[model samples]
Target: MAKDKKYRKKKLGSYPLASVVFSVTLALFVMGLFGLLIITTQNLTQLIQENIEVQVFLQKNLSENEVVKITKILSSKDYVNKKAGVPQLALITKEEAAETFIAETGEDFVEFLGDNPLRDVITVKISPDFQATENLAEIKKEIGFIRGVYEVTYIENLVHSINKNVKKISYVLIGFTVILLFTVVILINNTIKLALFSQRFLIRSMQLVGATSSFIRKPFLSRASMFGLTSGVLASALLWGLLQLVSSEVEGMMELLHLEQLLILGGSLLLVGLLVGFMSTFAAIKKYMKMSLDELY
Candidate 1:
């Protein structure tokens, strides 16, 4: 009798499980792809913001000490980008600017006009958190107040466009993610229901032999959890494979899609799979548990 019970327990949750895992895995992989795209967009936004340089032109005829003072002030600001504990600020002296202009335009303006019209400038890359239009304007106002600073300037239109487009993209992607989640739930529920159809009679036989409802649900739920976990792992594996293919075919792809971020995405997928799988299985089993013998036929 004990052996028979063990056999029944094994058979109840083990057969036809492959189809459930495949269906859930495919759904999760699709969702994972979209998740990857969303994170990529975020990364691109940061990269663009890092390149948005704010040029701080200095006052004319300033002494070396004054120039050093201005540089120190700008470097101390919170908005300035940093790398490895060093501020990313560059000073382009008027002499270097004239050389660059002469090289580019094929005309030595300083030699022609007897003066270098270009001003010495300090350029700073603003952090992404301060890349908003209003934030940049405030930064310009604050930096312009610094002594020996002539003018603070940046591409205002570019900043506005980035802020606007980021909002729009976030809204669109979030909407799509929510819609896909709902669709996946339906797909998983339907797939699990059909898979459980063949087991309806076995479930009824268990009940006829005085099995309780919770007892009957145990094996199915246990198997559902297992299938959910397997599906999540398989889905994550497929996503990793896709990333590998992309990184091989496309240069610098890994820079935008980082491995550390994968942990959050993978955890989300595992959670979704387990939650949806377990709930759908419970619901399907309840329906069978409530049905009469004729309904099984």
Candidate 2:
């Protein structure tokens, strides 16, 4: 029983129960959290970009035929956003615009000026792909060329600000992800190395008994892989729990979180865990296998 216990302990690298598993699971969980942040940020950016609208003010007193033609032309353009095959464009007649103005300010502008000065405006939301300043400028020029169209206008400064800030945020997230990846690799590597430090004597004993490197490495590698897989599963569960809690507390976050993306991130964690575990264990085993007795002591 004593010898059997000793052998089993040796096989485990003499690691304290749960130490290696806990360390690996914590690292994977942190990485998963960061991945969720990146995904949410991207979704929010796209949502904001899609909401931007451009105003197309029409020439006064256009006939019904002319107005219908303008609507059809704008709707046919590739840049216009659509939902359920209907273009995301709305027409506000001069009278409606005046009514809205008066409702908001409690002043009847038509009564004050004796004539409504508001022109008919058609507001169309452009697709997220064309929200940039240059793209909006091109779109405005194209819309202006249509007959009976007075002018096309949008918030130039707002568009520029959104594009600029999105680029900045993207760069920062990418840089942080790279750094986190490097850190996680080192963290997992050192963790495995520390766990195997106690197994030096056992490895040397196996080596003295004429055991081949592959024979000695098989059990250690297998257990390391198991530990990695367990850690990955635990990490994924934690991530899912976090997502659920956040979505419940924060409105609209559920829509931002995508199942496909979460699945991919979870898969990536499993892959990272297995690869790192196998490689780190192999390196640690090889180091102990080559160490002299004096060094082992």
lDDT of each: 0.89, 0.90
Q: What is the lDDT of residue 39 in candidate 2?
A: 94
In model 1, where do residues sit more than 4 Å from their true spots?
A: 1-10, 83-85, 102-114
What lDDT is obtained when candidate 1 is compared to the true structure? 0.89
lDDT tens digits by residue: candidate 2, 6-34: 77776735555498889998999999999
lDDT of 1 by residue, 1-297 (tens): 999977765576554767889999999999899899989988997788788889999989999999998999888989999989788899999999989988999987788899888889999999888888888999999999998889999989888998899899889988998898899889988988898888898889888999999999998898888898889999999999999999999999999977789999998889888989899999999999889999889
Clash count list over all predictions: 0, 0
Q: Give all TM-scores, in the order shown.
A: 0.89, 0.89
lDDT of 1 at 180: 88
RMSD to true structure for each model, in Å: 3.2, 2.4
